[model samples]
Target: MINKHVERANRVITVLFYLGSTLLFILLILSGSINHFPINKFYWLSANTSNIPGAPYDISRWTFWGLCAEKNDKNVCSNYLSPAYPISPKDNFDTTTNLPPSFVSNRSTYFYLTRFDFVFFWLGLIFTGVNTILYIFTFCSYSFTKVVWFLQILASVFTISAVCMQTAAVAMAKNAFKNYGDDVSIGPALMGISWAILFLTICLFFMTGGTFIKKGYKHHQNYVEMSKYKEDALKYQQYMNSTKPINTDNASNPTDPYSLPSTYDEGYQQQNAEKQQQQQPVDIIQKSAGVIQQNPKSSVKFFHFKKTKKIPHNDDGSV
Candidate 1:
């Protein structure tokens, strides 16, 4: 049986792990390393010196949107190829439009990082889902403890990888912007939250390591107890055998203690009879001696009578 406290602790950790993964998933989807286009006009300047003021745009993997300054002293905004954008698309940019070197560099870096980030994100999600299913199995079914532990470790590894990938993506984006001498901002506030959650998840996963240790300790204790009990039982059995009375009779019959053959019984009876005969003479001698001691007067009277009879006979012969 698992200790209740350990079980409860593991449950809490599993819940936290699940929550952290979910929050990180959401943050990864909603927040990107690049928040918006830089505001400065010079940042958008290309090699050509014609100086046609270029638009400021947010470029993402899915779409591009920008605010353009027109000659009429008005601002025009258009979201191109973006279904989620609130505004309608303006005239598409001509193929001849010059693209900024910094924008091109940032775009290349963003796409490269995002591709790997996407891979890690999906891997983390799949592992998290599997871990959740395992948790449910552990709660409802009779799953092996080691199996659950293995699954938890796998989930943790996946989560850590995903967190690392996303962090690297953000770092790469910032580094790219810095290399170009452009001011950059990492945004949505959710990125920090996601990182914090990932840290918490990792901590909880490490904490669950204790559960495995505790279980192994308990198993060792039980094994020791069982071995000690067996030794004690064997000692008790040996002691009982040593103290048990040994029956000398060769008879195999267990129902009767005096189940001897007729010949053996006759021999035993003859031995008893000879012993009584030998003691009879000794008993008779002892009885006679005791009677003489008790009748001392009678013994002396008999001796005197014998002496008188002899003297009378001698006197008659003399007369």
Candidate 2:
């Protein structure tokens, strides 16, 4: 049987995970849109371009929307652009004199990858938002759970794609800088948040899908009742077999639906014997007895016949 408390707890946990994922996604999307405490701090790639004369800033950081140049303790960021282009010395600063060979050779490769990463991130965020809005409806019916599961699947696909693209683009950029003998490092904050969101998304997907396997409350109750009835019937049969001799000859199969109660007593069994016999005629009794004997492990109760009453007939037709 499905415990109501356990079900409620699972729902609460799933909701919490969903909320966490949504919040992280929002944070990721807003990282490069503005220059502020947390946002200005979050970037995918950071490099020391102090020695590169053509480089505009001593230190450059790549964000989701644009690039930021950090000097001293302050950051001077460019205007936010949708689908921001990645940091390529030749493309961004308009000079490639002291840039890495890989940066020039693979400039277009980084550009398209970062752009698609931005796009897929937004797509994933949108799907997650839809799921958040429709999540409450899932509690109203099982059909809504299925709907939410589908939405979770779509969200997972986009989120995974975004994370993969972001990781690939940033890793490639960092490697190029390293190979050029320049000081470079990948941004831990951005990568951490992105991967965290993906983790939450995956967890939510499986939790929502698990609801499909759950049986309804009514179904659980029915199953429990049938199980209890069978248990009681089995116990009674064992008790009777141990206490009394088996009348194999007189024993006839019975087809009656009635079964022995859990707490069997001699008085109660004797009193109900006649009524049980009345309910199941002799033919039914013979059949049921045969069935029970064949399968002694069966839950069907065996009934003992006591006596049958006879009706008197009038001698004359007029009477």
Candidate 3:
């Protein structure tokens, strides 16, 4: 069975981690939406698109919104869009002129990859939020613990899928841009945060799973204790049932203590035999004493006393 103190401590730590992971996930979701201070710094891809015809900007950075480029020596981003937002350059520019051959040919790939990445990320965040709320209540009830465990599993899966998709989308885009002889790189902050979320989700999953194992072990221990108690109770009951009152109905032998149970144990029988042996010597001694009292001469011999001479008093008178 798991130690209560350890389990409680583990649960507190797990809840704290869940809260932290959810907070980070929310920040990631809000990155492109807010586009200010720290949020704007988190993007998926940054590349130089100046060589491509019909491209509006020389340097383009893609975020959850549309794109960001330098304006007035400061980064300016497009308006925010809904989740599962595609990242197709050809579609965005409304032209196929001078776009990278990979971007044009694999338009559907980029569209689905980026779209699925956002969709899963949003789903994961929602599930993780619910998980965080429910985790606190796990200490209150076993039912809550079970529910939270299940939710943790779901959240972990969603978060892992989202992270995997994000990595794939970002890496593929980076490679494509590099192949086109353009300078391109993935945003370190976004990818790093995404991976961190994944790691935390996995840790939470294992922690939740451990709860079930601990519960199972505790149940087994209870069962063992109950079985032992029942066995001891049964033995005591049998002992009580085995003992029967002496047949006092027959007044012939009312003082017999050994008659209560005819099935006397070996130890009791042995003690009784010893007592009879001890009394035998006492009986012989008593009988001998009675015989010695009946005969005075035998009593003197028995006690080893010497007889006195009758000549002593006569000699004293004559002298």
Candidate 4:
């Protein structure tokens, strides 16, 4: 079951990485100060009197509209409402708005800025720092068991915590800007879609980081087990090499007895007995041949076999 989950994690991380790349690209194009999206209406205040320009933010950062705007400030760089009318150049409230205001531009974005944008940014930064430290220590050269696990646990904590806080930061920043001036800005409507993509990207990063830690942890466990096995095997090898007796009969015998283990000593003796039985047959043949050679006609009684007759069974007086 753990193996299946591990595979699933791999697939999820791959898919999410691609998704995150797309979101990052979009975010980059949206967060810049260029004219991709009207980030600040004040920058375009000279464009037209009747025509209300869009927020300075792009579709990715539409949530930032009116974030810096005041209740009655028309010159506010991020104001999302129209100026009051009879639309005086002096008044801040909109009276006859021709177009909606804007706050963010669609030119460039930065991940580092998100950490500074919300209440949880500081916390996230701290966790990210811890995660980075663990990542570095994990590559240490010494072989201390469980240090790797410790690093992994640390990494897991930071990875999960940082991602969660980042998620919260994104949400809180959006909500704060949305509630500005007691009204939802036009920017969020246009750029709010990008938030979902950004969230997906963040989710991918966190999952991948956590998966990496698990892989390392499992690998560390395997190493520890293997190391123990090797130590035991080495001990057994040393005992065999040192305590085993040397073979003295190897030079006299055709085969080496020391090669046989101590438990096989009885079997070795039986094998020697069988060898003696086989030699007896050869000795009898040799002695008979020698006697024949000593005398050309040796008086030896050679016996011949004859068939014995059996009486047949007869009944009564018949034969």
Question: Backbone clashes per model, in order?
Answer: 0, 10, 0, 30
Model 2 scores a C-alpha lDDT of 0.77
The CA lDDT at 175 in model 4 is 44
**For candidate 1, what is the TM-score?**
0.47
Residue pairs of candidate 1 with colliding backbone atoms: none
Per-residue CA lDDT of model 2 for 165-263, tens digit only, reads 889888888888898899998878889999999888888888877775563455578899999999988988887776655333233334322355436
Off by over 4 Å in 3: 1-5, 71-75, 223-319
What is the model-wide C-alpha lDDT for candidate 4? 0.40
lDDT (C-alpha) at residue 109 in model 1: 46
Between candidates 2 and 3, the TM-score winner: 3
Q: Who is ahead in lDDT, 3 or 4?
A: 3
Q: Could you list the CA RMSD of all candidates, in the order they appear? A: 15.8, 17.0, 9.2, 15.4
Top model number, TM-score:
3
Per-residue lDDT over 39-123 for candidate 4, one digit per residue giving the tens place of the 0 to 100 score = 3322111212223333232221222222223223222333343211111211222232433222122101222333233223233
TM-score attained by model 3: 0.68
How big is the positional error of residue 86 in model 3, measured in Å on the Cα after superposition? 2.2
Q: Mind giving the per-residue lDDT tens digits that candidate 1 earns over 14-50?
A: 6767766666665444322224322111111111113
Error of 3 at 266 (Å): 22
Estimate the overall C-alpha local distance difference test score of candidate 1: 0.49
